[model samples]
Target: MAWFSDAYHFEKSQLTVAHVTDCHLFKDQSGEYFGVNTAEYFARCLAAIAEHQVDCVVFGGDLTQDHSRDSYQLFAKLIADSPLLCPVFWLPGNHDELQEYHAIAGPHILSHKRITFQGGQLLLANSKGATPAGWVKQAHLEELSKGVDDTPSVVFCHHNPLPINGYLDKHLLENGPQLLNALVNTHHCIALFHGHVHHDYKYAFRGLNIYATPASSIQFTKQTTQWQQEDLGPAFRLITLNFDDTHSVQLTTDVVWLNG
Candidate 1:
């Protein structure tokens, strides 16, 4: 990860969000990714988040390890059985089949939408492109940028727009610089959140804060040039957004590690 956190953030908020990403699930419920049962871990994650009274949940993509229809079906079933009562939103990751995922997914995935909360709204940028690397079309970028203005806002996607200077750096969003510039230009943008690096990362560019939530499946080693996984449990990011009548938002973040 390119950034650091000296201490955990806060304890209370108006709009609380749980961001779960990089599930890498399989068709079989007992499937594992590097010894971690992806499906079970994801279920554990949802169970843990259910305790928090979150206003919404954002699945940051890569729902399937094998990109199979059965995998997506399992994903749909899990959420259907999940105790989480909040609104759910999702986007495509590098491994996600952008072209066929919608049809293949038993429960149709929603189109690009916003998660509106008390103070402002959350925008999703589709960074899924031609390969493992990310690419957002100029038209879509412009559309996403238009939503952020004087109102406090946050952006979510699947790829890290900036590199973490590790093996994942090679898979950084291809046109990420432009994407960053688009969001940066939105002075009211509060932060950008994503997954794909498989590690918790925090970054700031041109005053726009960014974060990468840990995967619900496996955790990756940070700051290493080589590929590696850490002995860690399934996890997700808890974002507490406190807003004022002035339409500005204050955010505090914490990652909830499950006992999987």
Candidate 2:
């Protein structure tokens, strides 16, 4: 449902984002991930996102798995062919190639690392470190500090800041605490949303709220200590944002699971 306060506030102060992630698409159109068709699954995700009427869409990362240039192009093609009309923003994942993402020419896709709204600023930080584990560069940290002004804000990245399980935790963001202390916790960030863990999770770290979104392509079994995959339904997140009397933003987020 849309936010309602007064008509003007309702119209101007509300923002809804469709957060999708971890498609893991390969170069070939028929490529599948352990029997799951990543491209088809991504198409389903785009259709699901279209239903939300979001102001914008954020592809939280892991856009490709094979690390091929063609894979990234196919991702762009899928977005161009999808029903989503809102601006699309993305960041690179551990499996993605940075140069190809920078070279992509498309519609609706934005090169913006930061977007400002009447409610607050939305900062997209690149957490693609040297390894599978996440690390934000010194420059990104500087951007995060500058973008996160006195205005209330939210953060998006490709890596989870906290450990989730034995298998997933093995690749957890290497300097997660440093990231939290430097930008997320120190600034006026209400919540930090991420997707590398591939499970729906919520955590409170030093009074900051961090949320993880399930993958648009697949979900690893969350209860496992070892690596395991569930052929379960895929899901995305619908984040609704509204500003309060003090100009601080309040967000209501729900996970939308796609039908099998």
Candidate 3:
């Protein structure tokens, strides 16, 4: 972790968080998706994350491809075996069953949708819908309003809250405008993090940074009419929150690719 600090700004009281998403692990360890070995790739990503020694880690969803109890158990075991010495948080993706996740995830999982640090708050919402698409319900928005305060915050969910174009747009969050309205009302949010896109992306929505991380298992090609995999390998985002003299926090993000 100290070895990697030179690549990014480090300040006193700064919180470093590693974000990994869309592992898409299958029940069988040897299972391959689109000619890529997902489980092996995910393992390598975890090994890379361990080197960062982050304060905490967040799994941004799509934790499983088979949606089986075995898959979640395997995921738990992998994390347990890893060298990450911090709290772990996770949410459900479209492929996941919330109830099953709750049962397997146990206590480390966030019961409420928010976590507060000395400098800022981390808010999470469930966006998975009945179909493959997603929706941030009105109730979720209300919850977000209650959780957010004066502190700069980052919101995390499984689906992209804004459209990115091409075939992916068809499966975007259905009530994205409503979700954005809710976020706008918060007023203190600095960024929004999500998965499901399976590629690295950064954009701004109403002055807030919207970041989408590449999947831990595979990378997706952008601006395609149909699903396609990029030749690149797995990656994760390293986020740092540094406070200024006025106690205001500044957020910075860096993407770490396992194979380049």
The TM-score leader among the candidates is: 2
lDDT of 3 by residue, 7-71 (tens): 11123457888889998888887877777777878888778888888877888888888878888
Global lDDT of each model? 0.80, 0.81, 0.77
For lDDT, candidate 2 versus 3, the one ahead is: 2
Summarize candidate 2's per-residue lDDT along 78-136 as a digit string, tens digits: 88888888888887788877678878846677767666667775777789888999997
lDDT of 3 at 233: 86
Q: Which regions of candidate 1 deviate over 4 angstroms?
A: 1-13, 98-112
TM-score of each candidate structure, all chains considered together: 0.89, 0.92, 0.90
- Backbone clash pairs for candidate 2 read none
Model 3 C-alpha lDDT versus the unseen true structure = 0.77
Q: Summing lDDT over every window of 10 consecutive residues in candidate 2, give the lowest-scoring window.
A: 1-10
Per-residue accuracy of model 1 over 32-91 as CA lDDT, tens digit each: 899989998898888888899776778899999988888988887887788877656677
